[model samples]
Target: MRFPGFTGEWKETTAAETCSEFKSGKGLKAENILSEGLYPVYGGNGLRGYTSTFNHDGFFVLIGRQGALCGNINIAEGKSYITEHAIAVQANTENVTGFFQYLLLNMNLGQYSDQSAQPGLAVNKLLKLRINLPSKEEQQKIATMLSLLDARIATQNNIITTVC
Candidate 1:
Protein backbone atom coordinates (compact mmCIF):
# COMPACT_ATOMS: atom_id res chain seq x y z
CA MET A 1 0.00 0.00 0.00
CA ARG A 2 3.06 2.27 -0.10
CA PHE A 3 5.75 3.19 -2.57
CA PRO A 4 9.27 1.74 -2.47
CA GLY A 5 11.88 3.34 -0.13
CA PHE A 6 9.08 4.28 2.27
CA THR A 7 9.11 2.49 5.60
CA GLY A 8 6.83 2.16 8.60
CA GLU A 9 3.11 1.40 8.56
CA TRP A 10 0.73 4.13 7.49
CA LYS A 11 -1.40 5.74 10.20
CA GLU A 12 -5.15 5.19 10.26
CA THR A 13 -7.28 8.34 10.37
CA THR A 14 -10.68 9.64 9.44
CA ALA A 15 -11.14 12.05 6.56
CA ALA A 16 -12.20 14.78 8.98
CA GLU A 17 -8.92 14.52 10.86
CA THR A 18 -6.77 15.19 7.83
CA CYS A 19 -9.09 17.76 6.30
CA SER A 20 -9.35 21.19 7.88
CA GLU A 21 -12.82 21.77 6.48
CA PHE A 22 -15.70 19.84 4.90
CA LYS A 23 -18.86 21.64 3.80
CA SER A 24 -21.46 21.46 1.08
CA GLY A 25 -21.15 24.20 -1.48
CA LYS A 26 -23.47 27.15 -1.56
CA GLY A 27 -26.46 27.02 -3.88
CA LEU A 28 -25.63 28.08 -7.42
CA LYS A 29 -28.14 27.66 -10.20
CA ALA A 30 -27.29 26.76 -13.79
CA GLU A 31 -28.62 30.12 -14.95
CA ASN A 32 -26.09 31.89 -12.78
CA ILE A 33 -23.12 30.33 -14.53
CA LEU A 34 -21.67 32.79 -17.09
CA SER A 35 -19.58 31.86 -20.14
CA GLU A 36 -17.35 34.94 -19.85
CA GLY A 37 -17.05 35.11 -16.09
CA LEU A 38 -13.99 35.39 -13.90
CA TYR A 39 -14.27 32.21 -11.78
CA PRO A 40 -14.95 28.57 -12.56
CA VAL A 41 -18.11 27.08 -11.10
CA TYR A 42 -17.86 23.45 -10.11
CA GLY A 43 -20.73 20.99 -9.77
CA GLY A 44 -21.00 17.26 -9.12
CA ASN A 45 -19.40 16.40 -12.46
CA GLY A 46 -16.57 18.97 -12.30
CA LEU A 47 -16.37 22.30 -14.12
CA ARG A 48 -19.95 23.08 -15.06
CA GLY A 49 -19.22 26.60 -16.21
CA TYR A 50 -17.96 29.99 -15.04
CA THR A 51 -19.23 32.63 -12.65
CA SER A 52 -18.57 36.23 -11.77
CA THR A 53 -17.78 35.59 -8.09
CA PHE A 54 -16.27 32.91 -5.89
CA ASN A 55 -16.78 31.60 -2.38
CA HIS A 56 -13.67 29.50 -1.85
CA ASP A 57 -9.99 30.42 -2.16
CA GLY A 58 -6.85 28.27 -2.38
CA PHE A 59 -6.70 24.50 -2.99
CA PHE A 60 -9.41 22.02 -2.05
CA VAL A 61 -10.66 18.58 -3.10
CA LEU A 62 -14.25 18.56 -4.30
CA ILE A 63 -16.34 15.37 -3.97
CA GLY A 64 -19.55 14.85 -5.85
CA ARG A 65 -22.34 14.76 -3.26
CA GLN A 66 -25.26 13.44 -5.32
CA GLY A 67 -26.46 11.76 -8.53
CA ALA A 68 -25.06 8.69 -10.29
CA LEU A 69 -21.57 10.18 -10.05
CA CYS A 70 -21.72 10.61 -6.33
CA GLY A 71 -18.29 10.25 -4.72
CA ASN A 72 -16.46 11.55 -7.81
CA ILE A 73 -13.42 13.68 -6.89
CA ASN A 74 -12.10 16.88 -8.41
CA ILE A 75 -9.53 19.47 -7.35
CA ALA A 76 -10.30 23.18 -7.26
CA GLU A 77 -7.37 25.57 -7.17
CA GLY A 78 -7.28 29.28 -6.50
CA LYS A 79 -10.52 31.27 -6.56
CA SER A 80 -13.57 29.19 -7.57
CA TYR A 81 -17.23 28.67 -6.76
CA ILE A 82 -18.60 25.30 -5.77
CA THR A 83 -22.26 24.43 -6.07
CA GLU A 84 -24.61 22.47 -3.78
CA HIS A 85 -24.04 19.19 -5.62
CA ALA A 86 -20.49 18.86 -4.33
CA ILE A 87 -18.68 18.91 -0.98
CA ALA A 88 -15.25 20.42 -0.58
CA VAL A 89 -12.42 18.75 1.37
CA GLN A 90 -9.85 21.34 2.43
CA ALA A 91 -6.72 19.69 3.81
CA ASN A 92 -3.68 21.39 5.24
CA THR A 93 -0.82 21.07 2.75
CA GLU A 94 1.69 20.64 5.57
CA ASN A 95 0.16 17.25 6.44
CA VAL A 96 -1.43 16.06 3.19
CA THR A 97 -1.14 16.96 -0.48
CA GLY A 98 -4.47 17.85 -2.10
CA PHE A 99 -3.83 15.66 -5.16
CA PHE A 100 -2.87 12.63 -3.07
CA GLN A 101 -5.95 13.09 -0.92
CA TYR A 102 -8.08 13.33 -4.04
CA LEU A 103 -6.72 10.04 -5.35
CA LEU A 104 -7.32 8.34 -2.02
CA LEU A 105 -10.85 9.67 -1.85
CA ASN A 106 -11.72 8.48 -5.36
CA MET A 107 -10.36 5.01 -4.61
CA ASN A 108 -12.50 4.45 -1.51
CA LEU A 109 -15.62 6.60 -1.67
CA GLY A 110 -17.88 4.34 -3.73
CA GLN A 111 -18.80 2.05 -0.83
CA TYR A 112 -19.89 5.00 1.32
CA SER A 113 -22.39 6.26 -1.22
CA ASP A 114 -26.07 5.56 -0.55
CA GLN A 115 -27.64 3.77 -3.48
CA SER A 116 -31.21 4.82 -3.07
CA ALA A 117 -33.61 6.46 -5.51
CA GLN A 118 -31.13 9.24 -5.86
CA PRO A 119 -27.53 8.20 -5.24
CA GLY A 120 -25.86 10.45 -2.70
CA LEU A 121 -22.87 10.81 -0.41
CA ALA A 122 -23.59 12.02 3.08
CA VAL A 123 -20.96 14.34 4.49
CA ASN A 124 -21.22 12.84 7.97
CA LYS A 125 -20.65 9.32 6.64
CA LEU A 126 -17.85 10.44 4.38
CA LEU A 127 -16.04 12.15 7.26
CA LYS A 128 -16.01 8.88 9.17
CA LEU A 129 -14.48 6.90 6.30
CA ARG A 130 -11.11 5.45 7.22
CA ILE A 131 -7.90 6.40 5.40
CA ASN A 132 -4.25 5.39 5.62
CA LEU A 133 -1.95 8.37 5.70
CA PRO A 134 1.57 7.92 4.36
CA SER A 135 4.52 10.19 5.03
CA LYS A 136 4.52 13.59 3.34
CA GLU A 137 7.42 12.59 1.14
CA GLU A 138 5.68 9.44 -0.01
CA GLN A 139 2.56 11.41 -0.74
CA GLN A 140 4.50 13.88 -2.84
CA LYS A 141 6.17 11.06 -4.76
CA ILE A 142 2.92 9.31 -5.54
CA ALA A 143 1.23 12.55 -6.55
CA THR A 144 4.06 13.48 -8.84
CA MET A 145 3.96 10.11 -10.54
CA LEU A 146 0.22 10.29 -11.04
CA SER A 147 0.41 13.86 -12.32
CA LEU A 148 3.04 12.89 -14.86
CA LEU A 149 0.85 10.06 -16.07
CA ASP A 150 -2.08 12.43 -16.34
CA ALA A 151 -0.03 14.85 -18.39
CA ARG A 152 0.95 12.05 -20.74
CA ILE A 153 -2.67 11.02 -21.11
CA ALA A 154 -3.68 14.59 -21.89
CA THR A 155 -0.98 14.84 -24.51
CA GLN A 156 -2.12 11.64 -26.15
CA ASN A 157 -5.70 12.80 -26.13
CA ASN A 158 -4.75 16.08 -27.76
CA ILE A 159 -2.73 14.28 -30.41
CA ILE A 160 -5.68 11.98 -31.13
CA THR A 161 -7.95 14.99 -31.45
CA THR A 162 -5.57 16.69 -33.86
CA VAL A 163 -5.21 13.58 -36.02
CA CYS A 164 -8.97 13.18 -36.22
Candidate 2:
Protein backbone atom coordinates (compact mmCIF):
# COMPACT_ATOMS: atom_id res chain seq x y z
CA MET A 1 0.00 0.00 0.00
CA ARG A 2 1.21 3.52 -0.85
CA PHE A 3 1.59 6.10 1.90
CA PRO A 4 -0.67 9.15 1.50
CA GLY A 5 0.72 12.72 1.33
CA PHE A 6 3.96 11.31 -0.08
CA THR A 7 4.58 10.68 -3.74
CA GLY A 8 7.45 8.30 -4.28
CA GLU A 9 8.06 4.92 -5.79
CA TRP A 10 7.90 1.70 -3.79
CA LYS A 11 10.67 -0.14 -5.59
CA GLU A 12 10.49 -3.89 -5.61
CA THR A 13 13.29 -5.63 -3.68
CA THR A 14 14.15 -9.20 -2.91
CA ALA A 15 14.27 -10.22 0.75
CA ALA A 16 17.98 -10.90 0.32
CA GLU A 17 18.69 -7.22 -0.34
CA THR A 18 16.36 -6.09 2.42
CA CYS A 19 17.60 -8.50 5.09
CA SER A 20 20.81 -9.92 6.44
CA GLU A 21 21.31 -13.33 8.03
CA PHE A 22 18.18 -14.73 9.64
CA LYS A 23 19.05 -16.24 13.03
CA SER A 24 16.96 -18.51 15.24
CA GLY A 25 16.56 -18.01 18.99
CA LYS A 26 17.82 -20.45 21.58
CA GLY A 27 15.41 -23.03 22.94
CA LEU A 28 14.54 -22.66 26.60
CA LYS A 29 12.29 -24.96 28.53
CA ALA A 30 9.11 -23.63 30.13
CA GLU A 31 9.70 -25.49 33.38
CA ASN A 32 13.12 -23.87 33.72
CA ILE A 33 11.92 -20.38 32.81
CA LEU A 34 12.68 -17.62 35.24
CA SER A 35 9.77 -15.40 36.15
CA GLU A 36 12.01 -12.38 36.64
CA GLY A 37 14.32 -11.43 33.83
CA LEU A 38 15.09 -8.64 31.41
CA TYR A 39 14.76 -10.49 28.09
CA PRO A 40 11.64 -10.75 25.94
CA VAL A 41 10.48 -14.21 24.88
CA TYR A 42 10.10 -15.05 21.19
CA GLY A 43 8.60 -18.29 19.97
CA GLY A 44 6.71 -19.87 17.05
CA ASN A 45 3.97 -17.30 17.61
CA GLY A 46 4.17 -16.48 21.30
CA LEU A 47 6.42 -16.16 24.32
CA ARG A 48 7.79 -19.23 26.09
CA GLY A 49 10.17 -17.56 28.53
CA TYR A 50 12.70 -14.80 29.27
CA THR A 51 16.46 -14.74 29.71
CA SER A 52 19.31 -12.34 30.44
CA THR A 53 21.45 -13.48 27.53
CA PHE A 54 20.92 -11.93 24.09
CA ASN A 55 22.31 -11.80 20.55
CA HIS A 56 20.87 -8.67 18.87
CA ASP A 57 19.86 -5.20 19.83
CA GLY A 58 17.80 -2.28 18.48
CA PHE A 59 14.81 -2.69 16.12
CA PHE A 60 14.30 -6.06 14.43
CA VAL A 61 11.40 -8.03 13.02
CA LEU A 62 10.68 -11.74 13.56
CA ILE A 63 8.85 -14.30 11.47
CA GLY A 64 7.65 -17.67 12.58
CA ARG A 65 9.72 -20.32 10.82
CA GLN A 66 7.46 -23.29 11.53
CA GLY A 67 4.00 -24.24 12.75
CA ALA A 68 0.47 -22.92 12.15
CA LEU A 69 1.55 -19.32 12.74
CA CYS A 70 4.32 -19.71 10.23
CA GLY A 71 4.85 -16.40 8.44
CA ASN A 72 3.44 -14.49 11.39
CA ILE A 73 5.21 -11.13 11.88
CA ASN A 74 6.46 -9.36 14.97
CA ILE A 75 8.79 -6.49 15.87
CA ALA A 76 10.81 -5.57 18.95
CA GLU A 77 12.56 -2.57 20.40
CA GLY A 78 15.67 -2.52 22.63
CA LYS A 79 17.15 -6.00 23.29
CA SER A 80 15.19 -9.20 22.69
CA TYR A 81 15.43 -12.98 23.10
CA ILE A 82 13.59 -14.99 20.46
CA THR A 83 12.93 -18.71 20.23
CA GLU A 84 14.50 -21.27 17.91
CA HIS A 85 11.47 -21.52 15.62
CA ALA A 86 11.49 -17.82 14.68
CA ILE A 87 13.71 -16.21 12.06
CA ALA A 88 14.91 -12.65 12.58
CA VAL A 89 14.85 -10.09 9.78
CA GLN A 90 17.27 -7.22 10.09
CA ALA A 91 15.62 -4.69 7.81
CA ASN A 92 17.43 -3.09 4.93
CA THR A 93 16.46 0.24 6.42
CA GLU A 94 19.15 2.00 4.40
CA ASN A 95 16.91 1.29 1.40
CA VAL A 96 13.56 0.99 3.23
CA THR A 97 11.84 1.74 6.50
CA GLY A 98 11.91 -0.90 9.26
CA PHE A 99 8.40 -0.26 10.52
CA PHE A 100 7.02 -0.24 7.01
CA GLN A 101 8.81 -3.49 6.33
CA TYR A 102 7.08 -5.02 9.33
CA LEU A 103 3.74 -3.65 8.10
CA LEU A 104 4.38 -4.91 4.60
CA LEU A 105 5.09 -8.43 5.79
CA ASN A 106 1.62 -8.72 7.30
CA MET A 107 0.09 -8.86 3.83
CA ASN A 108 0.69 -12.65 4.09
CA LEU A 109 3.00 -15.13 2.39
CA GLY A 110 1.07 -18.31 3.04
CA GLN A 111 1.07 -19.18 -0.64
CA TYR A 112 4.85 -19.32 -0.46
CA SER A 113 4.79 -21.36 2.72
CA ASP A 114 6.45 -24.78 2.45
CA GLN A 115 3.59 -27.08 3.20
CA SER A 116 4.40 -30.03 5.43
CA ALA A 117 2.65 -32.35 7.84
CA GLN A 118 3.28 -29.24 9.92
CA PRO A 119 3.10 -25.81 8.25
CA GLY A 120 6.01 -23.38 8.24
CA LEU A 121 7.45 -20.50 6.23
CA ALA A 122 9.52 -21.72 3.35
CA VAL A 123 12.78 -19.85 3.79
CA ASN A 124 13.82 -20.58 0.24
CA LYS A 125 10.66 -19.01 -1.19
CA LEU A 126 10.47 -16.28 1.42
CA LEU A 127 14.08 -15.14 1.19
CA LYS A 128 14.03 -14.41 -2.51
CA LEU A 129 10.66 -12.62 -2.68
CA ARG A 130 10.61 -8.96 -3.67
CA ILE A 131 8.56 -6.17 -2.13
CA ASN A 132 7.44 -2.74 -3.32
CA LEU A 133 9.55 0.08 -1.94
CA PRO A 134 8.98 3.23 0.13
CA SER A 135 11.32 6.02 1.17
CA LYS A 136 12.65 5.80 4.72
CA GLU A 137 11.12 9.14 5.72
CA GLU A 138 7.66 8.23 4.43
CA GLN A 139 7.93 4.76 5.92
CA GLN A 140 8.79 6.14 9.34
CA LYS A 141 5.95 8.63 9.15
CA ILE A 142 3.51 5.94 8.10
CA ALA A 143 4.69 3.56 10.76
CA THR A 144 4.39 6.27 13.40
CA MET A 145 0.91 7.14 12.22
CA LEU A 146 -0.16 3.49 12.44
CA SER A 147 1.57 3.00 15.79
CA LEU A 148 -0.30 5.90 17.37
CA LEU A 149 -3.61 4.51 16.19
CA ASP A 150 -2.66 1.09 17.57
CA ALA A 151 -1.66 2.53 20.94
CA ARG A 152 -4.88 4.49 21.15
CA ILE A 153 -6.92 1.43 20.27
CA ALA A 154 -5.06 -0.68 22.83
CA THR A 155 -5.62 1.92 25.53
CA GLN A 156 -9.29 2.04 24.72
CA ASN A 157 -9.48 -1.74 24.87
CA ASN A 158 -7.75 -1.76 28.25
CA ILE A 159 -10.18 0.81 29.55
CA ILE A 160 -13.09 -1.19 28.28
CA THR A 161 -11.72 -4.37 29.86
CA THR A 162 -11.30 -2.64 33.21
CA VAL A 163 -14.80 -1.15 33.07
CA CYS A 164 -16.31 -4.51 32.27
Q: Please report the candidate that would top TM-score against the real structure.
A: 1
lDDT of each: 0.81, 0.70
lDDT of 1 by residue, 10-34 (tens): 7888777877778799998778898
lDDT of 2 by residue, 1-164 (tens): 56668887777877677666556666767754566678877776756667776656877677777877787777756787777788777766474346644564676855566778888776667777777657777767777887788789999999999999
Candidate 2's error at 153, in angstroms?
Answer: 1.0
Stretch of 10 with least lDDT, candidate 2:
95-104
Show model 1 residue runs off by greater than 4 Å. Answer: 1-4, 105-108
Q: lDDT value for candidate 2?
A: 0.70
RMSD of each: 1.9, 2.5
What C-alpha lDDT does candidate 1 achieve relative to the native structure? 0.81
| Candidate 1 C-alpha error for residue 147, in Å | 0.8
